[model samples]
Target: MALDVGMFEGHRVNRAAAERRCATLTTRRSVKKAHQAAWLVNAVRCVDLTTLAGDDTEGRVKRLCAKARKPLASHIEAGLGLSAGELTVGAVCVYPTMVPHAVKALEGSNIPVASVATGFPAGLMPLHLRLEEIRWAVAQGAAEIDIVINRELALTRNWQGLHDEIAAMREACGDAHMKAILATGELETLNNVYSASMVAMQAGADFIKTSTGKESVNATLPVSLTMLRALRDYGMATGHRIGFKPAGGMKQAKEALAWQILMKEELGRDWLNPDLFRFGASSMLGDIERQLEHYVTGRYADSSRHALA
Candidate 1:
């Protein structure tokens, strides 16, 4: 009698062969679980100084820092808290002079202030003035600084100039978290965005942000996907983990979740934490709240009250 080779050759097989394949599958699953465990351990061990230092501050500064670190839901609850256990959201991003307003809005909540600097929308200012703007922002309690990269230099292939400007701005940021905006719309190409993303990371950007929100063209999925990939590659090559923020055009809960999904898919679960991801928007928080409310209440919110300004 001839052996039935057909059944044994593929996924379908005799009992004995299937048993052997089951053993292989079990071993592979065990190995994968072990690898994931190791990755999780390393991630837990990695310390984010920004987050750690945030815990030590005091007064309004401490509140803002904590609020900045809180998830979007927590921020909204603070505003609507009818009880004593709830605290307001603490961190906000605003124009240079608007730092005080953000600070006041977040008062008693202990949120830190963030300000956009260096002729933010255009970034067409002298180096000294930009540095001064950063200093002034920090002096006014801006714990986070978002600076726009000069698009002309980036577009003209002036990598070194762009790098130096970012480095200078980083220094001027002092201890504040420095988010370098690529202004993706102006870059106008995936290749440019990728190259600029690498330049920003290599030049000392604590976070490589997608856009300034002032431009007509704002952050998009393709541009964000490209930037995240560049950061992941850069991290692998240099062993320095970089953060990503897709700012502008993020207006709805679905949009925020889409960016979150993109980050998780592109950068892995290790980057899913707040330390590695942020959504830069003046209007997203309210949408996130409304969605959360709808999830719980099964109805859209009567009014959307969350606004950065």
Candidate 2:
């Protein structure tokens, strides 16, 4: 049902006036106080992970394992270029094998490397093996590690096992930032995602990612929102700020922008930094290049091949 604008004109006029009056009431002192208050709140809410459920938490270990075998050279290169000059939405999350390509593509660029570990997409490997994988990626120049939690352990209510693995991976990352992939698509439940997010954060995950981009069901708005909310709550309880990344199936510039907006609105301005937010995209770079070309040249290119490296 569509409503007539004329019917609400009087109310709209009053609302506009009220807004103007309120705007005028925002004194410099009040504004400063508000800013300080927000800063204090942000400082208090940031935190780490807490616990987990079991290994079969979502029954997606096999699927993630398979996608890991696929080649992702082009995607990694493109993602690095997309964030080369202009302000970027986030870090490039890639497979361990693709870390070198990403490093080469983003060399000297501000965009950092985020490589997956712990048998990425699948957390079915042993804890020692996962740690070794993380160490190797870091040695290969990965600026960050996006490791998967043992969903099987989470599903079985083995919170301790999951926590220990995450802690070890975090340590393996050395000085590089660690992002924990929840693989929400496999979990298929907000409750499960929440539990996993809390666990990863408590175990020292610098960021809580939504998916690995390898599942049929990758990042979803609902799942991302839920994870963000959990991170926000966790931050409030602890004092360590955690980042959020929604990877997979994000191919359009608008989709990336939407996630950025969501993160800013839900988590506040402090979370909008690149270190705290990122888009784990595989194909959105071309779209961004096209847009930049159109803005600069007055015409869009059919392909991104001509874009500078």
Q: Pick the candidate with the highest lDDT.
A: 1
**Top TM-score prediction, candidate number:** 1
TM-score, structure 2 vs. true: 0.67
What total of clashing residue pairs does each candidate reach?
9, 26
Residue by residue across 80-193, what tens digits does model 1's lDDT show?
332342332324666777666556655555445667888887899998999999999899878888899999988886777888888888888889999898999998666678
- For model 1, the stretches where C-alpha displacement exceeds 4 angstroms are 1-90, 104-110, 304-309
Give the Cα-based TM-score of candidate 1 against the true structure.
0.71
TM-score of each: 0.71, 0.67
Write down the lDDT that model 2 would get: 0.60
Model 2 agreement with the true structure over 1-309: per-residue lDDT tens digits = 121222112221233433343333223223223343232222112211010113321123222222122111233324434332233323445567666766665556555666778886778887889889999999988888888888887776566677787888888899999988888888755666777777788888898988777788888777777787778877777777898877778766445555555666678887755567766654454454454444444565675453211
For model 1, how many clashes? 9
Error of 2 at 226 (Å): 0.5
